[model samples]
Target: MRILYVITPSRLSGAERMLLRMARVQQRHGDSVRVLSKPLDAFERAAADDGIEMVTGAIGGKLNLRACPTIVEHIQRFAPDVVLTMHSTGTLWGVRAARKAGVPCVALMQAANTRWPYTTAPAAVGCAEFVRQHLIAGGMSPDRVYAIPNGIEPEPYLDDEDRDRARSDLGLTPSDLAVGTLAHFTPRKAHSDLLDAAAIVTRSVPELVLLWAGEGPLETKLRQQAARLGLADRVRFLGYRTDAPRLHRAFDIFALPSLLEGLPLAVLEAMASARPCVVTAVSGNPELVDDGVTGYLVPRRNPQVMAQALIRLATNDEARRTMGLAGRKRIMEMFTLDGLMQRLREVLEREIRRQRGPGG
Candidate 1:
């Protein structure tokens, strides 16, 4: 199968990382996959390292009619069996271009809260059941929307030696408990709420430290906030780590207090590393965390509640270890990369057969 993926990414977030994983897995399975995206630094390097073919171009604004012809031209050249788009802008332009070029288009729905503009595509793929229901509720055909959760390879995250080295590099002592998170420093991610929770939790558990990885526009502001709250010594902002999975080893508990999410890959990665998560109760979060089983789920923007949960895991080594093991077991059973790719193949094949109609 020849698959063309279109995306416009400003940074390497969850959705972008999933795209890379999807492409690499598909390529390994003997599918010819190509990506068309803006030449962002991390994305370009990672895509090249994975040996995925890439075409760099600007997507312009959301309603950029001028970019449509360029996309159509690429569609003509690639002659893809199917075109899969990442989010809103990609779906809008990609569906338009694919329709113009007479190719099947599938939009990968990454968020549950945000509504997409175009619904004319033949099919849409959602990362979770919530997203699929959201699409259907938004007037999309039920048959057109398919639910396929995000998946990852469990091997890369299973390195204990690398984990120890990462912890040592971060200047973490054996006595210190680290509450870590890997997310872009964005308002929706609610980094401030996490900071607030850290403040509360640290008062009781002074050995607790914050290991925040990933970079974004909110870095300076968050740094200042940490200082003003007298948490400068406790919080370590490691910007945009390429070794994020290894860093998961450094964490006693993984935290994400996002106001919104669509099955965050960060949480999945943390679980794969056998680290218990304390994430906000929002879309796709409950689906992953079994609430006090795999991990705890706190309400969004509630520092008090989030702090209490974090403190519980931080203080109890046995509970953390138990939850972490359960989390890893859950991921291995349901959310492996091979499982996701198999579902993706089924979706693509089903769409292709529908497009061909009666054995064409």
Candidate 2:
């Protein structure tokens, strides 16, 4: 199938990363795939590096009123069988442009919480079931919306050799229990909450270390919070990294105290790495984690609860190992890249066939 993915790119955030992954997978399967973004951000550059075509323009929230003709022209030139749009504000214009070009369109509701995009597209997709419901509530038909969770190409994270090499490169001791988080330093991700929890968890386990591996608008504030909590020495802030999969391997546990999520890819990567996770109860997080079974889940924005959960995993080595193994099992069983691609393949093929009518 010929597919074109459209997204607004100011950063290599999770939604843009999902577009890149989809482009890569579709291209690998002999599908002609290309990416369209507002500006040439790091995410677009990464897609180009992977040999996927990246098309950039001024088609964005501010330019939507005037950018329709240009977007239609691009779709005309590419002649895609389908166009998939991400980001809520961009969906209506993208779908309209594709329709003008006489092509079927699919909009992906990338965030867990959305108030629009449902009424914008003929079909919609999302990482979490809750997100799909959100889209439906905004007035989309039930049959037209799909709850397709994010997935991982686990080869990058599951490399045993890479784990040993990454540990050596980072100067991590063999017995050091490293807890890592892959999120932008932002209030929604609740980095401050994690820092507050870390302060309490570290008091019981002095050797434990925490890695905050992303840069965002809240970096300075979060740094101050960590310092104020006296966790500056134990917590290391590694700015935005493209090598998160390899980095996940260096950690024994992954903790995310997010205010909301739509099956975050970072969490999936952590599970694929067979590392235990402790995430806030929000969106699709609970769907992926079995609470006390695979990993721990704490109430969102509660540092004390997060701290207790972290301490529970830290104090028990066997529990951590068991949870990690269970996480990996869950990933293999339900959330691999191949599985996601297969599901999408079915969806796209069915849509194409439907558009073609019964005779074709």
lDDT (CA) per prediction: 0.88, 0.83
Q: Scored by Cα lDDT, where does model 2 land? A: 0.83
TM-scores of all candidate predictions against the true structure: 0.97, 0.95
- Point to the candidate with the largest lDDT: 1
Candidate 1 per-residue lDDT over residues 279-335, each given as its tens digit: 998988988899999889999989999999998998888999999999999999999
User: Top TM-score: which candidate number?
Assistant: 1
Candidate 1 TM-score versus the reference:
0.97
Please provide, for model 2 over 1-360, each residue's C-alpha lDDT reduced to its tens digit, 9 standing for 90 to 100: 889887766678888887778778888899998787788567766887888898888788744686677789889889888888888656867888887887888888767666665467778787879888877777778898898888888777776567878876666788777899999877789888888888888889877888878998998887787788887777888887888877988898999999989899988999888889999999889889889888998999899999898889988999988998899889988998889889988888877676556764
Q: What is the C-alpha RMSD of each candidate to the true structure, in Å?
A: 1.2, 1.7
Worst 10 residues of 2 by lDDT: 110-119
**Which segments of model 1 are wrong by more than 4 Å?**
none
Error of 2 at 283 (Å): 0.7
